[model samples]
Target: MPLILFNKPFQVLCQFSPQEGRQSLADYLSIPGIYPAGRLDADSEGLMLLTDDGALQHKIAHPDHKEAKTYLVQVDGIPDAASLARLQAPIDLGDFVTKPCRAVRIAEPEWLWPRNPPIRTRADKPTGWIAITLEEGKNRQVRRMTAAVGLPTLRLVRSSIGPFSLATHPLMPGEFVEIPVAALKSKR
Candidate 1:
């Protein structure tokens, strides 16, 4: 199996096709036949897995598979105990209710790379970091979850997916590394 772990940069579209004014996966990866197992919105950044094998892609991306994805988020305000509890519990996102997941405050990761064109800062407001792990992903779910609890997400980075982590296999934005299929044995 051909599998690639890519650190997607902010504002890069997740698809392989060309977009008129936006950067897409085609801009960085020339490997043919490999498709993104899942997607990260243009505004978000972080780890993405690509594979040529359809079954592998499904196993990684499908919600039913329950592979945990961890994200490091910078939000506009410091969350108190109530907010943290709310985040870890099932909460209705209007269209659907999120599954209970782990959510905790964290200091900014030392190994994080700076985002290009950085997020805005204000003298009047404070920002805080939180690490959230979710088993099921929804479109803009992290941003929504934070907003629902009165903390607006300013930066979002998916730091890890299942056994593959940026900490263990680090890559700068637009860089990717291929690992053997055996690396996935832990998941089985």
Candidate 2:
């Protein structure tokens, strides 16, 4: 089984599926027989995994497997501890309550890369960053979580998943690398 680490960029779809007027993984990844282990929304950017092994894919994608996925989020407002506490606690999204999540304010990284279509900035508004890690994957969870806490997410990026990291891989938008079966197996 082969597993690859990818640094998915903003507005890049995670899957190879075709969209009417949107970009997808097909535009970037050309490795035959490879598929994303999980998905990141086109509006979100960060670490994405691709693999040829069904079991390994399932392990990484299934919420029950509880593989931690960490994200660096720039939000519309400064998040106070009380607000962050609300995030760490479970959130009821009507359909279901989200699993416990970890969130904390973080200083802006000096090395953070700029987005191609940069996040909107307002002259009269101030914003901050938060680092959140969750075991369960959900639709726009971080964005939704922040919104629920009164701080809407302006930009979202996945920095790491399990032991794989975007910092080490350092792929620009529309780039990918294939990890050999031996390395994938050795990771365990």
Candidate 3:
């Protein structure tokens, strides 16, 4: 069994299968039977783990497992303390209420690469960064949560899932490194 760590670039789909003309993992990864353990939105970027083992994949991606999935989010406005509090609170999203998540203001990551098409800059409206960690992988949850708190996310990048990290693994966009499946299974 093989476990692979990939630095998924922005605009890439999480699946290996092709989706029309949009970029997919197949554009970067060629190995067979190594499906993504979890999903990252097409507009988002960062660490995405792939594995051949079903059990290991479930452990990392399952919502009930409550694995900490951390995102480095760039938002439009600097959220005040009250807005930050609202983010940590379990706000209702009409259909479902989000689980209480940890959201803390963080400096823009110095290690981050500029997006291919840079985020729109507004000299008048300042932007800031926040680290938001969630246990559930709901569709567009991070972006919705920030928006609910009046901080619209301009760019989002998932930095880690559980103990695995893009920094520790060290792969650039479109690059990946293989790890032993047994090693990944032992990690959590």
Q: How good is model 1 by TM-score?
A: 0.98
**Model 1: runs farther than 4 Å from truth?**
none
For every candidate in turn, the CA RMSD to the true structure comes to 0.9, 1.4, 1.2
Candidate numbers sorted by lDDT from highest down? 1, 3, 2
Which candidate number would show the highest TM-score if scored against the true structure? 1
Instruction: Give the better candidate number (1 or 2) by lDDT.
Output: 1
User: What residue runs in model 3 are displaced by over 4 Å at the alpha carbon?
Assistant: none
Quote the positional error of residue 78 for candidate 3 in Å. 0.3
Give lDDT: candidate 3, residue 101. Answer: 89
Tell me the tens digit of each residue's lDDT in model 2 across 56-90: 88999999888899999999989898999999999
**Residue pairs in clash, model 2:** none
Give one digit per residue, the lDDT tens place, for model 3 in 2-95.
8888989999989877889899999998898889988989999999888888987898889989899999999999978898899898989888
Model 1 Cα lDDT, one tens digit per residue, 1-188: 78999999999999988989999999999999999999899999999999999999999999999999999999999988899999999989999999999999999999999989898999899999999999999999999999999999999999999888999988999999988778666556
Give per-model TM-scores: 0.98, 0.94, 0.96
**Number of backbone-clashing residue pairs for each candidate, in the order shown:** 0, 0, 0
Please give the lDDT score at residue 113 for candidate 3: 84
